[model samples]
Target: MSRALALVFTASFGAMWSFYLLLSVVPRYATSHGAGGIGAGGMTGALMGATVAAELAVPRLVGRFGYRSVLAVGLVLLGLPALALRAATSLPAIAGICVIRGMGLAVLFVAGSALVPAIAPPARRAAALGVYGLVVGVPAVIALPLGLWLAERVGYAIVFVLAGGAALGGLAALPGVPTRTRAHAGAEAGRGVVAALRSPALAWPSAVFSLSAMAAGAVVTFLPLAVARGSGGLAASALFAQAASTAGARWWAGHHGDRHGSAGLLLPAVLLAAVGLSALTLVGRPIAVVLGMLVLGAGFGVAQNASLALMFEHAPPRDYDAVSAVWNIAYDTGLALGGAGFGVLAARTGYPAAFGVAGALVAAALVPAWRDRAWLRPVPDAPHCPRGYR
Candidate 1:
């Protein structure tokens, strides 16, 4: 990797570690503090809702402030408030902290993704993104489960302290990363998520990708709670398997998408998520639970890379920020909806049936995933088009 690209990855590592460490823990924390299932969902919803709200303005922020400034601010926002969680006893106070962190996550998502294509070679962009996935995904694999384990053994206060320190540590790499992407001037300066959504090419893939993200949100937020009581080890193991598989699948999908086509992978990716979620309906079986998560994680990973690579493949270099923002908005929006909606649904229907319904909902998205492949059909002689658009 180029030095600048390495620096971007380094900075992103800290942001992602802090985010994932608290992702599963925060909901559980709320539940422990007497918030109940709905309240747990509310905490996740608040964070993701704030993230979606922040995403809308990030393209403009990056356009005005540049990558380094926005990224630096993002690190602080994501890191600092996590420390305050140790003292927060009320649900509202915790939600307020989550909102600030969510805004920080929005900036990191947009700026971090936009910087990749700007710095990497066009022919190997997806391969480079695979590396980016590893950088981000490693945290989900390690910290996601580790935080839960640490919370059980060490206490939430220590987890909060570690999360804060991880993000603050990323600041040391900021000076090495570039302030602006090469295409950040002129026409690109005015483009935003609205413009990107107006284009069917970007919208279709984003819509398809959102479904998998929804499933992911539900799994991350409720799986531990849904498992048989006192099976905390099982929950942690299932999550670890999910994150590890996701990281591996994402890395593989990026390379494959670069060589073949990202669009073709979208259909299978959605189907896999559906199948995995369906398996979770058999929640009493430990083997089934782990296998289900693994399958689901694989699908989610492929969708992550395929949807993103497809979007970046079609967009002009100048529209990177807008495309990144729109993609991330779809992502976080699905996560918010899934986390909040599933909790309410599960409260009424029970976990098994809720898992079934969530699976069916993801399966319903197949229509869009299938249609997106046609919309993304390859165009000969177009430099921005991918071989797999067909």
Candidate 2:
């Protein structure tokens, strides 16, 4: 990797560490401090809602302020708020802090994702993104489970402090990264969110990806509580399995899609996610829970890489920011909806049954995925670019 890409990856590592370390812990924190499932889920919803809100504006921010300034501000916003979380006991206070952190996460993701393809060669674009996915995934694999383990032993305050410090520490890498790339320097760059949303080429892949993202959101937010009590170790192990598989699958998918065309993978990816979610309906079985998460993670990983690669193939370099914005919006909005909506649904239906319903909902996305596949199919005799080229 080049120096600039490595720096971006380094910054991303810290940001994701901070975000994932507290992802499940914060919601559990809300519940422990006199809140119900809805409150816990609302914490996630508030965070992701703020993320989507910021995603809508991040391209403009990057355009105006350039990447270095925006990224530095993002790290500060993400890290500083968690330092106060140790003292904030009320649900409202916790939710408020999450909102600020979410905005910071938005800037980090939007700017970083846009920069990857801009920095790398087009032929290797998906592979570069695969490396990026692996970088981000490592934090989720380690910190997601470790936070809960640490909270159980050392207490939430320590975890919160660690989370805050991780993000703040990423500031050291900024000097190596450029303020803006040539792709982002033009006046016409980063202004196509609405236009991208309007076009079917972008919309179909986004819709397919959103389905898996919603399932992932629900899994990460509520999986610990969904399993039988005293299964904290099981929850941690299961999450580790999920994150590990996701990282591996994302890398494999990127390379495979680059060679074979990403469109063909979307249908199978959605179906795999549906099957995995359905298995979660049997929460009493430990083997089933672990296996289910593994499968779900694989599907989620493939969908994540394939959909993103396909979208970038459809658009030019100048629209990378807008494309990243649209993709991130779909992802975060799906998370918010799943976190909040599943809490309400789970409250009434119970967790196992709720998993079944969620599976069915994911399966409903197959129609769109199939449509996207048909639309994105490449002509057989056309000059070969990448497999995903029109």
Candidate 3:
């Protein structure tokens, strides 16, 4: 990996670390403070809602200010706001912090993904992205669980201080990232996200990725509630397994995509996810739940990498920011919608049947994935792009 790319990874790591640290902590904190179930839902809903909105707008800002500037500003917004959370106990105050942090997350995802293709060589671009995914995923694997533990052992105030500081510390890495973007023939990147969505090549992958993302949302959001009453620990373990699998598989998928093509992986990804969902039918069985999660995570990993790499392959470098925004919109919105939808489905049909239906939805993505099968074929034996496409 290049120095610049590595630096971006570092910044992303810190940003994600801070974000994960509060993922579970925030909702519980809100509930304890009198935000009832609906209020807590609003708390997360508001954060993700703002995050999706900002994800769309961030690409435009990247085109104007460059990646480092946008990213630095994001880190500041994400970090500085948390410092204030130490004193704010009301829902409105908490919501405000979530909104600011949500915007920061939007900036980090858009700017960072945009910067990746610009810095990494075309030949290994997918692999580089996988590594990047690993770097960022580490936080979710660690801080997510650690955050709650720290809060319980020490206190929420200390957790708040550390979380904010971790995010703020990422700013130091910003000065090292490049100010310019990868050059392209047209101004497509500046053409707005809606226009990008108009491309069938781009939209298809986004759709497929969204299906899998929805499942990811369901697993994390409802798996705990779906299991036995005292299975909170089991749910956490399963979630961790899924997250770890996704991370490892992402890198492997990128590496495999470089050697073969990403399109071929699409059908398999959906199928794997379906199998994983099928295993969830046996959710009452702890081992079955873990196994299903692992399989599903692997599928999700492949889908994530393939969709991203294929989108990048088709689009000119100029469109990277827009591409990033579009893919992330799929990610955040899918997660939000999946969690919301699955909740309703579970209430009506029960967890086991709901999971089966969720799998069916993911399987349905295969039709669109099939259409892109031929598109992802890499040039034989002679893999890797010759050089940077300036």
Candidate 4:
């Protein structure tokens, strides 16, 4: 990573760390305040709902305020509000905090992502993105479980301050990144998400990415419950493996993607994640569970890097903000939808059957992945650039 990109990655890590630290903690916090399991789940739902809403609007916000300004405001919103949680322990107040913080999450990701295409070295952009994914994905591996562990021993208030501070601390890194908005000749005209969706090249990658994320949602949400008894601690180990594998595979995907078109990686990744999710139906086998998540994570990582790289490649330099917003929207929304829907299906069909169904759903995404293979072929012409560049 370049020094500038490293700073952005650090900021990304800090922001995501705060987000994941509270990911599981908030649910239990709600239950302590007399909320049932359903209420705990509702808190997460509310947070995601707010996050998606904010992500859609952030492109416009960045256009006006610049990345540094909007990102600073987002960091403050994400970090500062947690300090107030001690004063207002009511469920309503808690939910309100989540809403405000959710907007901050939206801004951080969109701004951070837009920065990637601009600052990354052109030839090794995929590898740079792999580095980006690794740093950012660390929170999911560490903070998620650690937050709950710390909350039990010390107290939620301490955890809240630390989490908030992690985000706020990132302000030091912000000054290093360029805040200048883009000035591509046609950038303004093609500025919105709607315009991005109208382009098949941009839209299809997001569509396929959402499908891979659906299984990721189910795995992270249900794996522990699915293997409660016999799997030894391998289930948790598997999760760690999954996170680590995803981080590593992202780098590898980028390396190979640069050599052999990124779009070619999509179908193979779908196949891998599908197999892993299918194996998850064998809930009793420790090895299967471990290997399953490992493979699934690898595929998910590949999908993450490939789809994002493809989006940046096909879209003009001008549309990076819309591209970032759309990608982040797809990322969070898919993960949320996957978890929510899988829970319902699992209730009716049981974990094994539900997991199998999830696998089938991912496999079905292969159809779209296959169609998008055209992305591997050389472009007939580059619309955004001149003839010499094409």
- Identify the leading candidate in terms of lDDT: 1
Give lDDT tens digits, candidate 2, residues 316-341: 78788888988988889888888988
In order, what lDDT does every prediction score?
0.89, 0.87, 0.79, 0.77
Candidate 1's C-alpha lDDT? 0.89
**What does the lDDT read for residue 368 in candidate 2?**
54
lDDT of 1 at 301: 91
Task: Mark the regions of model 1 whose C-alpha exceeds 4 Å error after superposition.
Answer: 186-190, 368-373, 385-390
Candidate 2 has its poorest 10 consecutive residues by lDDT at 379-388
Task: In angstroms, give how far residue 307 of model 3 lies from its true place.
Answer: 0.7
lDDT of 4 by residue, 1-390 (tens): 577778888888889889878876776687679865345545666676677789999888877777888888989989998777767678898889888888899999888988877777566666677778878778877776566667777989988998899999988899987776454334454469878877777777887887777788677656655676554255457767787778788878777766776777876886888898998888777788888888998999998988888787777777888998888888777776765677677878988998898899889867855765665454526553212123
* Colliding residue pairs in candidate 3: none
- Candidate 2 regions off by >4 Å? 372-374, 378-390
Model 3: lDDT equals 0.79
**Which prediction has more favorable TM-score, 1 or 2?**
1
Judged by lDDT relative to the true structure, which candidate is superior, 1 or 3?
1
**How high is the lDDT of residue 134 in model 1?**
84
Q: Backbone clashes per model, in order?
A: 1, 0, 0, 0
List ranges where model 4 is wrong by over 4 Å. 28-41, 83-94, 151-158, 181-189, 229-235, 368-390
